[model samples]
Target: MATQNARKQDPQEALIDDLRDVLADTEAMIDDVTAQGGEKALALRGKIADNLRAVRSRLYDAEQKVAGKAKEAARATDTYVHDHPWQSVGVAAGVGFLLGLLVSRR
Candidate 1:
């Protein structure tokens, strides 16, 4: 139960950390933009914006990849059950019977 709860919270904690880093980077970028002048500042600003956009795109792609992997896992599980229905059932029954026996012994 504790492990499951931790796993559920882990992504949110990681996202918060990532946001903190991005915020720090943005603050630094702002300082850099202020330090430069005229055309240089503008160019730097543009580059910073482009980099932020690229980071956003990469984050989205990574999320899509994770989702795809989860879907693939679900499909693979489904395929396995379909291909080995009797084997899967037998294994499950065997495990349940062994657990029951252990409990009875206890």
Candidate 2:
């Protein structure tokens, strides 16, 4: 039960953890660079920037994939209804009539 609770955390919690780790490391690097002077701090900053960019790219790709899948599903549904207009209309009407009958009885 404990494991399940941990596993079922809101998905954003994992991203938040990752961002927190990155921030902590960045803070540490900044402190180190401040104490030590130039080259090492610049290198750490560059690495942090690269990591952030990669995370952004991955997020963008995921969004695009989800949108594409949604559009494809909508198109497929539209095509199916177009191909079976009478059947779809009959089914919808039957459902509506049944609901109306039940409501009137109550």
TM-score of 2: 0.49
Model 1: lDDT equals: 0.76
Query: For residues 3-106, what per-residue lDDT tens digits would candidate 2 score against the true structure?
Result: 46547754544454455566667667666766776887678767766776786676666556666877999999899899999998999999999999999999
Q: State every prediction's TM-score relative to the real structure.
A: 0.49, 0.49
lDDT: worst 10-residue window of model 1: 12-21
Using lDDT, give the best candidate's number: 1
- Per-residue accuracy of model 1 over 10-73 as CA lDDT, tens digit each: 4744564465478568868767787877887888787887877777776677667767877999
Q: List the residue pairs that clash in candidate 2.
A: none
* Regions of candidate 1 where Cα sits further than 4 Å from its true position: 1-45, 93-106
